[model samples]
Target: MVPEAEFTSYYGRPIVKPSPWEADIPAYLFAGGLAAGSSLIAAGADVTGRPVLRRAGRLAALGALSISMAALVHDLGKPSRFTNMLRTAKPTSPMSVGTWILSMYGPFAGLAAAAEVTSLLPEQVRSRGPLRLVGLLGRPAGLVAAVCAPPVAAYTAVLLSDTATPSWHSAYKELPFVFVGSASAAAAGVGMIAAPTHETGPVRRMAAAGALLELAMEQRMERSMGVTAEPLHHGKAGRLMRAAKVLTAAGAAGTLVAGRSRALAAASGAALVLGSACTRFGVFEAGQESAKDPKYTVVPQRERLEREGPVRYQP
Candidate 1:
């Protein structure tokens, strides 16, 4: 049985201080992942000429990207000092690289989303020369963004991984898969809600891939952290992840047979959405839970400290 415990810092070093950033930071991370996934779905629809899905996916991507930008800026320690983020790009540093990627991808994605909207307009409206010009130029932008977007989506996991945040850093492999799956699910959810489900073949495929990867990573993550993984396998994270896996599996399997019928599509979509959101929240909660525990921090530190004994004073 677990002993009654009081919270203490990790090795007496702060495990977490309330991040000074506003809610927008986390909100934006979710939104941005959604945008990246949606854009990829939209691109797939564009190739398949499923204008309904294409348009809806594009719009969702754009709206989410815009919101993400706002949230990211708001999260900057010194919003005014944001430019300093550009000073360098270190592979070991996820944030620095992420900032650069976002800088390049955001506008291009916005433009791509805008171009997709033209496909939905009346021919007369879409015929406007300037809009046509924008559409032509934006086409490449969308493709570029989509190809690049997956990394951007994955980078969030890396960002959190490098931090002292519990479970996040140690569970690096699993975290990226989690984000990837969640992003894909989010994209499918938007497509199912706004577009005709009959043509959501691409979305369904993405959902299948997402669900598979998430479940696999989660299992591996659980096994990877013999001791540290305790927080993830217990409490809210475990419960939520368990629920997510069940829902995601059910939803993906349903999609395999959910042909044309709108009802089946909607239900599957909802399940996927719930699963994805739970994954994100579970991850966040798990990190916090792990951080709050002394055992998680102390045990790891003690191992490290033992490996390298305390510094000796020079007489």
Candidate 2:
């Protein structure tokens, strides 16, 4: 019997060009998610009367957003290139939508964080009219940031999955869930680290919920992706993903017992943040790797064609 012909593309070159993005893109993704999640946590803390948690979350939101914007600008190679994206909004374009989201989110997050800073000023300065005004505006600004948070956390997944990259495109259905969950875990970690143990009940619950959701979504995505998922399971991507899973799981479990000890809470929180970062980087690497291998492209197309048959054109 004749052996099946091996799938090859022009001396084994990649069938699709990998995205030119480097580490900056993944960093952007993680920071953006963290910013979004932190904003949400800040809002929650505000409502629950947890001053420390609220302050930390607001500061983190602005700081993370700044990092995210910096990374995106660096990846674009010019600040002007990013601004150009704002000239016209394209509803159909993920990049355009995401840019707009960032624009809206940045001002609110900044205002919220500025308010927090004003509150930290010396009593005399904070009691002054200008600082007092800023402090008064903080809650509303933080609320607005919370309102904008979900899209910020989830848009990067849509942006990544909108591309032709096999792993990213194939896993589009689950990527958003994974991203949002990771964001939640990271934000909860920040709250846990900064808030008093008595005020961390909600944060611990968020950590456990987010970790579980992220882990579940990742598994489901990989299982559904078939051959395209191979990149996520091997190489540097695999190692990072494994680390993420371990850290996230351990952090979630730790939350259950970390209530009594500030040190344990801080360690658990750090693990969750690191795990979230690893998850983003792992996903980024997997997409890049899938784009580099011809088989990831060919096998999926072949399987689809076999299932759907050839397209017929009408004269």
TM-scores of the candidates are 0.84, 0.97
Q: Write the per-residue lDDT of candidate 2 for residues 1-315, one digit (tens) a residue.
A: 999977678976888999999999999999999999999999999999999999999999999999999999999999999999999999999999999999998999999999999888899989889889889999999999999999999999999999999999999999999999999999999889988888889999999999999999999999999999999889999999999999999999989899779999989999999999999999999999999988889899889999999888999
Clashing pairs in 1: none
Clashes in predicted model 2: 0
Q: Scored by Cα lDDT, where does model 1 land?
A: 0.78
Model 2 root mean square deviation, Cα atoms: 1.1
Give candidate 2 regions above 4 Å deviation.
Answer: none
In order, candidate lDDTs are 0.78, 0.95
